[model samples]
Target: MAEKQVQSRYAPDLMAGQVALVTGSGSGMGRATALEMASCGARLALFARRKEPLQETAEMIRAMGGEAFVVPGDTRDEKSVEAAMLKIKAHYGRLDVLVNNAGGQYIAAARDITNKGFEAVIRNNLIGSWQMTRAAADHFMFENGGSIVFVTAISTRTALTGFAHTVAARAGVTGLMKTLAAEWGEYGIRLNCVAPGTIKTEALGRYPIPPEKWHELNRSVLGRMGVAEDVAGTIVFLASRLGSFITGEDVYVDGGETLHMGHDARDMIHPDMFQGRQRGDGKNE
Candidate 1:
């Protein structure tokens, strides 16, 4: 797979001496973020399910004269995550940042979603991320102190009609980050989350989105769709020393999409808008 374009403004040594472990580094936002951090001089332990794609990421990092090691493992499995962490600790000798970016969920109406489908998404997005975070904390962050960033989806804020599974999973992840921030602060481990709005990626093609829907998504105040690099920049910032004081907060990098609803209207407001009878109070039929 070709490496995603990474346009960053951080200094070359912004992450010097830092060892970061990024799950799902094979492609998509994970690969983009990994490249950005490597550009900033962070040694990377790239984790993903497939070995070939992880090798591709490692090659890209090495091409830039940066250091990276591929740790191929499924994020949903605790044993896989534990092995990845052990390998990272052995390879890098220390872990400074953990980027929980490995997650997947298919779009389905809330009413149509089956128990098996919902559970799978939860395992991939919520439990997997938590396992990685806990492993990193127990393995290195507890003693060395570090930053942990969870790459969640903006659906947590503006809940999507068809993507209930992802919305719920990401919402849980945000809650986990908030609680971890409070509990892990004493150990000097800062925890935070980054929620990205709809962004252009290879995976976007898999979704059943039409061209007009894409256009509607682009009207997010900025009048454009977000690229992977936009999210990567924020991830690099949180992983670096620049965000030392920021913790337990979520940064929405969606071009102001979450701040305002879809599109603004100029229709006049009715005087009786607030005087409408309650729905179920036996008022207006």
Candidate 2:
């Protein structure tokens, strides 16, 4: 429930004179990324379905003497995306970076997932993100060249259960980004992904997970729960000039959680399943 502090370890002017567009900037990771990029001195164009939250983000940035333009719209709609891009060009004259941070998913077993539910998640996560990328390229990045960072979930690597739809969509985005990286390279445009794992955000709290279960989730090699700032900083790095040579790389900002998948599941479950033989002891008893 505590508020997340906004602070970037990067130089203040790391992105000075640059214009960046961040989708889903109304709250959570998108807002965090926008704040971080603004702190790094980039002029921001914020997008989301709601205008109030987007304006709140803009106010926060402007309060810090940073510039922000709020353009509320749904990422799933091509017309909305095109209009937002046009507004960005008209207002900022150019866009140097884009953070595709808008996406949604609900937990449900693969078998229980309805056809509509699956398609909805796919539309929000994969199709919408691709549309934004294409629009950005068509409007500004194609000629000016820029950095594109897709905020994907680490579920792809860990293959987390009860969310097959989301996992598949994120995986598809990662694959699309890799292909775009190669194709966009000729234009000096770089495309990459930042995969977050178990980040402590408002969205995670909405899940049916028990409070006690959080402790188990924190068993990452880092021995801590990742905050939105952790993922946001990684995004800023990938979008900044410092990552000039990096492209098509999917960076996992998950505190090594993906690398250690299935470890916590075993710990959380009763050991009786082992039939008196504990795991990792090399005993088949």
**Tens-digit lDDT track of model 2 for 1-285:** 233345679999999999999999988999999999999999999999999989888888887789999998988999999999989989999999999999998989899999999999999999999999999999988898999999998887777788999999999999999999999999999999999887888887788998668868664688888988899999999999999999999999988887665555546776675566666556565
lDDT by residue for model 1 (174-242), tens: 999999999999999999999998788877878888866787766466888888889889998998999
Clashing pairs in 1: none
Quote each prediction's TM-score: 0.90, 0.90
The weakest ten consecutive residues by lDDT in model 1 span: 262-271
**Candidate 2 structure lDDT:** 0.90
Q: Rate the local accuracy (lDDT) of all candidates.
A: 0.88, 0.90
